[model samples]
Each structure stands twice: as structure tokens, then as C-alpha cells.
Target: MINRNNWRLVKDYIKYRAEIDQVSAKTLRLEETWLEHTLNWLGEKSIDQAPRIRPVFSDFVLSESENKYSSEYLRKLVSAHRRFMEWVSINKEGYRHKITPAWLKTIKLPRQPEEEREHEFVSYDEIIQIARTPIKSLRDQRIQAAAVLWFLSGIRIGAFVTLPIKAVNLDLLEIYQFPSLGVKTKLGKSATTDLLLIPELIELVKRWDQLVRSKLPDTSYWFAPLSPETGTFDRSIKAVGENRTSRAYKDLKELLDRSGLPFHSPHKFRHGYAVFGIKNFTTLAQLKALSQNLMHSNISITDGIYGMLSNGDKKKLLSSFSPATSSAPTDLNQKLDEILSLLKQNTPIKSE
Candidate 1:
């Protein structure tokens, strides 16, 4: 029941996003898919009619809610529609009058459910348990190393799977996530990321690095491909396909199964890294370093994503706070002021 004109407008908006915005193919596809849902909801009405028919948009939300779409998905759909309408208002004549900023602001989704908001992060103890699990083969060893590296470096799985042997420097505890070197970083971001200096984790990574380097050339993937017949490192296979993530995910699942541990997605390792740093790093200066190491653009981005404490942790933190005295230590007061100043500036703080 999608209107042909509306569909055409959607296509044009998608084209603009590709040619002008230059979003990643994955992001472009997601935006297109989200718009298709909007078009279906539009039915016989054109895009311009959306502003006048507010109830129709509410009906669409109700239908999606009944269909059990996640709040996150609904939020993204709203964002996509807002962007599309903004584009239409700017580029298509007469849409400026119809798709006003006020109408755009009306497009919103409700807050996420508490359960959905509370996601698990892989803990340091869990990583330790995984490391201690006996390795039965070279493949097991490789997966174990990959898990350790994922938690230590806190890079995305796409970048991890695509990392070349040369990009990792175990001795320096650094990972070069340069797109030019073919690391599939999110938004093509490039950074020389530092690995968390956990001695046990570093040792495991070192062992794997030495094995991979000795067997394969520098250009080869650090997570080397294994032979189907022998189930050992296949040095001849230098490149990985787009399906590498699927394969790597399956391997991680298998490793977790073997370790007799509950499954957490590879991306949870990233959350785990952030949570670990947030808990341990007390000063704003230390936190700034942690944020930069995670390759976040700014401290606020890092804080917004991983700053919230769990209910239990928050309770414990509040309970442990002592009664305020008439006067505080001079050094402590100075540090508190410095932290507040840096936070307000939204800039990195220098370590004292």
C-alpha cells in the first residue's frame, strides 16, 4: 500500500545519503530498510501528508509495538525518518512548509525497558577463567588468544578479525587500527590503541603473536585461517572473506562451551573493557587516558556509554561514602576542582 511518489522520495533520500553523506554500506542499507517500514506505514498518503496526519504515525508505532520490535529499533526508525524528512525539506520544493522542524521534533520513541537497558559486560574474572581453560588444539589456542585480545584492546570485532599480524605490537602493548592497513574499523576510524596491561592477558597474546608471526607473513591475518582437513594454521590462506565475523563468532561460542562458561557476544568484551577501566581509574586524568585508549573521540562519549553504575554497585558506593567534614584536605580539594574544570571543558585532563 506504499504510495509510489513516497517510495521515489525515499529512494532519492537514500541516494543523497550515499553520494553526499557517504555513509558506510551497512549503515546505508539499515537506513533504507527503516525507510521501507515508514513507506508501508504511509500507505496511500504521500510523504508530505505525514505532518497533518499525526494519528497515522501513532498508529504505525502502535502496530510496531504490537509486532514486538525493540525500543532501540523503534528509536533508529524514528531517527531515520527524521533525517529523511529533513533532507526532503531542504531538497524538495514545498516540503520546507510541510516538514517543519516542529513536526520533526514530534518523531520520537519511548524509553527502553529496564531489562533492555541493563546489559552484561564480560568481567575480568570471567576472562581469567577463560584463559585457564585447557586448550585442546591450535584452533582453541587461537580463539583463546583472540578473546584475550578483544578484551585487552577493546576494539570492535570487525577490526579484530581484519587485523594483520604487523598491526599488533605485543611488546609495546599497542594495536594500530589504521584503515589503510585494512583494519575494518567503525566509520573508518584510525588509532594506535593501547592494550590493557594485564600481565596474564599480555602473556597469552604474546604466545599467540609469536606463533602467528613465525608461521605467516606480516600481511597475513593475526587470527590466521585454519586448514579444514588438519584443523591447524593454514599459512597459504592469507585473506579472509566478509563471512569472517560469522566464523569467528561460531569459534567464540565453541570456546565458551568448551570452557563451561556462559556465552557473551564478542562485542561484550568491549563493554567489559570500558566497565573495567571505569571501575579502576579513579582520577579524571586516568579516565581521559582510558577513553583515548578506547579510541573514543572525546571523554563525554566514553562517559555517556559506560559511566552508569549498576544498581547494586551504586548502592555499595553510596553506602561507603563517609560523612562530610568541615574542611577537606587541600590536595584533595585541588584535585576535585581540576576534575570539575576538565569535565566542563569536555577535554582531556593531564595527569598530576
Candidate 2:
């Protein structure tokens, strides 16, 4: 059981995060859940007691590990506790000296397992297969279009589901992810994203866009909710609710099942977009453009997430490499040197 003082402190910390840090409600809820677990584990001990009792913290972590909790779960718990401790140190004069920076450094989970680090993404062929699958209803068609758009644009599911019809410009191949326009972009980030130039997929997305635009107003969600009675779009619905992503997820899962394709979460489409761009776009400029399209802050982030090539791709690429010779550097070598220089600088290379 948590002591009343500890509980009150936790609530105060959460409120600070909400009002001062301005974190999303979803993030606050997650932090609260993780902090609750920490408090429960601490039992009669207060938050300040956690750092002093290093062995007790290790034991708690051991217990959670035995329960097969993921490294991510442990990481979040560590973050939540660290934030609470920092808040306590600053806000509560009594605990100021207890929670030191060196003590805070002790609050860390073990390194993640190698298997957990392996990346899994939807393949290009898989997206094409899903797109080509026959649709039995208008909802099915919309889901297909959404899936294709996700692959082409790599917008997060949150933004995709909350995207309004007005934000998507098919003619310019641009998607304006503005929070002010009600697009729920991650961290409230706004960017103008470009669609991949796949004509067949572009046409498919356009067809759905045209249909929705003709029926619903610009303010309405492009992936509009269906009316239960009419079995058509609910025109009265202007904005998507919080449960929008869950409903969209379920619909996508059903469509994947019907199409006889294995289900990959909406996020996998984002990985697919990155992988496709990396494989197809050879120039450093093109790679930078691809990173920008994915809305990543830097190319290093993009490379870190989607850089690994499959075993077969690696084998093929290695086999195709030219034999080393004591000659002047080739164009490929010069390009690689330039890429290395730019990567070291950690800057975006502009396309010519």
C-alpha cells in the first residue's frame, strides 16, 4: 500500500507534467500507470527511500524481469521514477539532498536483448498485395486506400486516422500534418509530407479521396465513420474521437484477414516506406528527402531505424561490389566518401 504522502506527491508530479511539460494525455496516462506500479512495488517505503535502498530497487527489477515484462516496460518505469525523484528534489525541501544526480544515474534497466532489437516491417510486395485484394464494401475500399496511403506517405496511424480531407492535396502529392487543422501528429509536430511516386497506388488513393470529397465536407475526416443504419459514411461526423485509431486498427485487421494476407500493424507500413526508399534511392540527396518524408528529425535517426538490410539483400549487394584495385577512386567510392562526411556533420544534404 502507498503512503498518503507518496500518493499525493505522485499526483502532483503528474499534474506538473500535464500543465507545465504539456505532454499529451496519452503520454500522461502511460506515465501514471507506470508510476502506480512503482508506488505499489515500494509498498510502505516512500519515493525518496528508493534511491537509498539500491538493493531493493534491484530486487523489484528482478521480480519484474521474472514476470517477463518487456525491456520497454522497464525503461518507462525507470523514466517515471526518475522524473518523480527529480520533481521531489526540486519541489520538496526535505528530500532535496536525498535525490542526487549520481544516485539518479543508478535508476536504469538492463540492456535490451538482441532479439528485441531486430526490426520487423511490412514488405513492399505485402502492401501491393493488400492493395490489390478485392473489396466487398465501401468500408473495405476506404481501408485499402488508407493502407496504401500509409505505405506511400508513412504518416503515423494517429495522424492518418485523424487526418482531415482538406489537409491532403493529391494534385501536389502533399499531406499537411498540422495539429491546428486537427491532424493528431506525434508530439504535435507539423510537416508537409510527400507521397511516394507509385502511379498505381497514387491512383487508388486518389479514387478514394475523390469519393470522400464528393460526399463529405473538407472539415470531415477522410476516413469517415460509417453510418450503422444506412451502411454508408456518417456525414454528420465532422471530427474523429479518441477511439478512432482503435476502430481503424480493427477495420484494417479485418481487411487483412479477408485479403488472405498476414496482419502487420499500421506502423509496419512506415518501416516499409523507409526500406523501399533506402533500396530504390541511391543518391545522398534522395536519401535525405526520404528521411524528411518520414518526418524524422535527422537522417541519422532514419538510418538507425531502417538501415539494416535483409540477409539476401546484403548478400546480393556484396556479390555485386567491384574488386579492389590500386587505382584512382571510382564515382561510387567518391559518393560514399561524401556520404560519410555529411553523416559525420549530422546535417541534412540537400537534393540537387
Candidate 3:
């Protein structure tokens, strides 16, 4: 059994790396859970006992796989183990090269399922329903606003929760996701994105923005806290910080139920933005603009991650590339016209 002191040392090392990596608090918390599960399973087993522990580790991974853990999840567990052991091999005395003989060489991660990989993004109609759903309560109104904002701005729920009222400029149709301003952006990234171009989406955001400002200071969350007692925004409440993200999810599910629509998380809105935006973009410049608006580092990252087309859409698109028909099979003039038309617009003529 690995001693308690050794476990503490491992934990400290993980913490040290987390700080250096600037991992989000939520992700760090999950990594801690994964590490704890692993170390507990290897209880009291010194790093040098890797050879004897190989079978045990393998069994543990097999059990998790059988229990329906996702390929992504299993991969994360393996990554945790690899990172921990690498530290152990380097820092622990007499543990040199020990990780190489351990189960790392034997473990193979499972492939991710296709259904999970190519999930459909939410549709514009769905967001309209979510936004227009009739509800009498202020809390319900807030939920509707949340849904519309997700569709319009593609804001991640984490950052949404932390947004202060002033962070959004409804008149300018801009959102400032500044972490130093307490927006809780991933990797503390700071950027701005324009709101959705649809007038309805803009109006929905405008209404909520005005309502929140009326009730609280500019620094209060745009999605203000709901008073548990009255089930509405507490105008008198002075406390400032993010509301629980889980509660926002619950509200979304409740809204979906009321609208008789399928439940999709706020993050899926981002996917919707990518899929729908790319589909209609008439030029390469427009595509690149959308990618930048979504805060992707490069156009390829945007395409690789969110540019998935449904099977039906793919077929329809390919059919458009087929040769044009003419009145007679030997109509050379018509055939040349069709070919020339296709060739003219084959590339985007829009200025970069």
C-alpha cells in the first residue's frame, strides 16, 4: 500500500501543475476526482510495486468500460494516471523508470462513439420557441432570456453565469467576455462577439438587459439571481457573484418541458451558431469572420469541431454540384453556359 504521505505528495504535485497550467477551477476539481479514484484503488502500493499493480489497474479500467463510461471519459482517466505516474517516476526517490513497467504500456483507450461525436446543433426555430414560450413568472422570463442569449451570442454557460449587466451593450449589440471583469471565460480568455443579427433575438436581449439594469447595479449579473422565497430577481439583494450554473441548467430543462421541445444544453447554442452560420456564409471571408466571432483560434479549428453537416444536408449540397440540364443533349451553347456560370462563382469574390 502506498503510504498516506506518498498520496499527499502526489496530490500536492497535481495541484502544482494545475496552477502552472491555469486550468479552470471546475476542470481542476474534476481532475482531483479522477486522481482520487485512481490513488484509492492503488492504496498503499508504492510506485515500485507497478509490476504487481498492472493487473489491478487493467481490471479497474475494464470495469469502468463495462459500466458505460465514455471513450472521452476513459481517456481522461488514463491521462490522469499517466500524468501522475510521470511525476512519480521523476520526483519520487528509487522510482526511476517505474512508470514504464506499469500498466501505461498495456492500456488502450476506446474510440469515441459517432453519435456522441456528430451531435446536431440546436435549430433557430427551437431557440425562437424557447424565447417566445409564455410564462407568467419573472424567473421563467429570465430562463427564456437565457435561452435566447445562448442562441444569439453563443456564450458558454460558465461565462454567462458570471456576466455583469454592464458587460453587455445592447445598443451596440456587443458582449465583452473579459475574465478580469469576472466573466469566468475559459482559460481566462477575453474577447468580444456581436449578437445574432435577427431582430427578434436582439429584442429579446434588449428586454432582459433593460429589466436587469432596472433592478440592480451595472455590476450585478445580467441574469440576476432569483430569490428563492419569491422566485424572482431580488432587486434589494446586494450580494454580487455568479449564480449556480447547475440551476441555470435546471431552468433550461424546465423551459424545454414547457415548450414541448427536446432539452439541449446552453453550450449546444455554440454548435448551432457554427453549423448554421457556416451553412449560409456566401464567402470564405464570412466563414472566417464567424469562426473569429466564436472565438476559435483558427478557421480549421472551427471547421473541424463544429462544421459537421447532417447526412441529408450533405447529400443536398453535393447534388448542387451536378452538371446542369439542357433542352437537348447536344446543346453545346447551353452546356457551356452552365459550366461557365459554375466556374465564375467557384471561388468567393468577396473582399477580405
What lDDT score goes with residue 29 in model 3?
Answer: 75
Best by lDDT: 1
What is the per-residue lDDT of model 3 for residues 195-271, given as tens digits with 9 covering 90 to 100?
77889877877888888888788988888987899887777755544348888889989989999998888888888
TM-score of 1: 0.89
lDDT, residue 180, candidate 3: 78
Q: For model 3, what is the error of residue 302's alpha carbon versus the real structure, in angstroms, after optimal superposition?
A: 1.3
Model 2 per-residue lDDT tens digits across residues 107-161 = 7776656443446677788888888999988988988999999999999999998
Query: Per-residue lDDT tens digits of candidate 1, residues 1-352?
Result: 7799998999888898999988877788899998877887788988888887756554577576785877667778888877888899889998898889888887776554544356577889999988888999898999999999989988889899899999999878999999999998988889999999899889988999999899889999999999989998787876768688888899899999988889989988888888889988877888888888778866778878866766666788788788574346887798778867876775777666
lDDT of 3: 0.75
- Candidate 1 weakest ten by summed lDDT: 110-119
Off by over 4 Å in 2: 54-59, 116-118, 324-333, 344-352
Worst 10 residues of 3 by lDDT: 342-351
Off by over 4 Å in 3: 1-6, 40-44, 56-59, 100-118, 235-243, 325-352
Q: Rank order by lDDT, top first?
A: 1, 2, 3
Our tally of clashes for model 2 stands at 0
The C-alpha lDDT values of all candidates are 0.84, 0.83, 0.75
lDDT of 1 at 224: 92
Task: Please list all clashing residue pairs in model 1, or write none if there are none.
Answer: none
How does model 2 score by TM-score? 0.91
